[model samples]
Target chain A: MPIPDHVLVVDDDPDIRTLVGRLLEKNGFRVSKVADGKGLQQLLEKSQPDLIVLDLMLPDEDGLVLCRNLRSRSNVPVIILSARGEDMDRIIGLEMGADDYLGKPFHPRELLARVKSVLRRARSLPGDVQEQDANATYRFAGWMLDVPTRQLYSPKSKKIFLSGGEFALLRVFLNHPNRVLSRDQLLDFSHGREIEPFDRTIDMQVSRLRRRLGDDPKKPSLIKTVRSSGYVLAVRVDRGGESHGSDDSGPGD
Target chain B: MGVEPDKIVVQIDEDLAEIAPGYLENRRNDLKHLPLALAEGDFYNLRILGHRMKGSGAGYGFDGISEIGRAIEEAAKQENRQGVEQGIADLAAYLDRLEVIYA
Candidate 1:
């Protein structure tokens, strides 16, 4: 028999945790519950869940930082839950690599839909992370992206330093190669917390990424900017390699 | 699902059996000590309790509990001393009268 997908929900409020737990269980997923970030880590040490439903206003640590940290290591799909439903909050949550975002006073049915949607997308690729890593190294435009370490290797074999925000944006673009990602879509994977409609923040990150990749902003070939819309990673990404299982799994509510 | 407040039945899911009892116990204890907070005029602490109740009650098949909790939280937030007292009284009266059944 196939194992039911496990969803670990991390929240400071026991009520919310339990409530979400009930909802997820009713939706045909195995559910584990935790009250704080600490509990989340402890659970991750035991096993990796299929997806994570994270709450932003944690008592111990900032959820966005936790999301970024999680992204730096794994491609685990995360759905952020926050009471702050402002556009800024949603953007920041997405920027932290949350695959999806929802606000409090949220409809339980909506959360279930997002849970299923993310799981479907994540599973569309090989359902196993180990299998993915075996051939998931994306190489494009003379740059090799090590998904596990989140390290960018230059043509000179030197490690390029990338801010958490920049790396997140780049990852989002890479995952959706050749696709025109709008500013709102860009916000889903960058680390900016401020909110504005199609602000220059994404542009700045793109410019920074171009410089790091040796792609000139004036004649950018790697990440091309489309007028009045968004940007696209124009190069084909190559993924072929032997794979290994990840020894670490991690986060909390 | 019935509005028979006297026969208020919280049909906690069987999966939550272990924790539901604890949740009820905790709320009972919280409600027990709430008078102390009210007498001390610690609206902040009172508000926190109400907030938890409001969020948890409906999630666990206890809409009535959540409604009372929301009222308490709102009163505390508004800092209306009279409203806070009335809310606390209402919560206490409900808890005192309602019966708990495990489904």
Candidate 2:
């Protein structure tokens, strides 16, 4: 028998933890439950689960901080489950490196479908985002991005951390700099998925990426938004940078 | 003349049958906590419990509980004692009338 995928569910609510764990187990996945960030870190030490279902309102640490910490160390897929159902909350969760976000009171089947979709997408991706273009470095508008290390450095050598979503979006922008890419194209390129109807995922991603790049959203010089259409990376990009950016600070610095 | 309370039948997922009893029992226990929290003006604990109920109730086939939970949470935020009291009463009535059917 093929080994079932393992999933870690981190939620402070015992009822939620039990429900989600049981549901995943019934769906042929090995499931583990943790109530806080401390438990998450302890479990991560021994084994890396295939995916994680994290709650935003954790006791010891917020889910966003945990997701950022996970991104710095690994590319494990995360689906945030939170009670905060606002659009901004979902965008912020995505900005913190979550692959997907589902609010509390969600149907079990909906969460199941998302888990399957994310797992399938993760499998179809070329190894890992960090491994793809392992040795390539991208430069645009005096900013540097090292693909292998997933590091971004500003013109003045100040390091800025990009969440997984931000990094992928930025990479797409750098690859096709100075061109107007539609939302569908950007979503397909960055996420390898078809655009859902009325999806503002790409727009929110662009906003987050711009913030990471220090491009003001009010009047972004890079990643300029085209009204009623898409966005354009208005900078010239060069790929052959010998220097892999300079910053003494580590990830999440 | 004594009037009978209305029976509220909720059909829940059969997959949840094993755990739903314990979950419902916990909510029943909250009946005790709700009055104590209200009497002591422990709005924080009341808000936490209300938020949890709001987030979890509908998923478990208790939309009425979720509605009451939302009301309680909102009232606690505003520190409206009357609203919280009404919400607790509604929750008690609903739980008393609830009949869970696993489908």
Candidate with maximal TM-score: 2
Q: Against the true structure, whose lDDT is highest?
A: 2
> Which 10 consecutive residues of model 2 chain A have the lowest summed lDDT?
A244-253
Which portions of model 1 show Cα errors greater than 4 Å? A22-28, A82-92, A103-110, A125-253, B1-22, B96-103
lDDT of 2 by residue, B26-70 (tens): 899989999999999999989888888887888787888878888
- Estimate the overall C-alpha local distance difference test score of candidate 1: 0.72
Error of 2 at A239 (Å): 29
What DockQ results do all the predictions give, each relative to the true complex? 0.17, 0.46
Q: Candidate 1 lDDT, tens digit per residue, B26-74?
A: 7778766677888898988888778777766755556777777777878
Which tens-of-lDDT digit does each residue in A1-253 have in candidate 2?
A: 2246789999998988988998899999999999999999999998778899999988789889999999888878999998877899899999989999998787889999999999867645633543455678888778888877889999998889877778877777665555456787677676543224355588788887888888888877777776765887776677765322222111110
TM-score of each: 0.54, 0.65
lDDT by residue for model 1 (A1-253), tens: 1235789998887768876887788777899988778888899888777799998767788888889888888788999986555799899988889999986656567788999899767644432433344335767766788866878998778899876666766777666566566676677444242323355477787888888888878877777777766887776666554212221111100
**Candidate 1, fnat value?**
0.17
Candidate 1 iRMSD, 1 decimal: 3.1
Query: In DockQ, how does model 2 score against the reference complex?
Result: 0.46
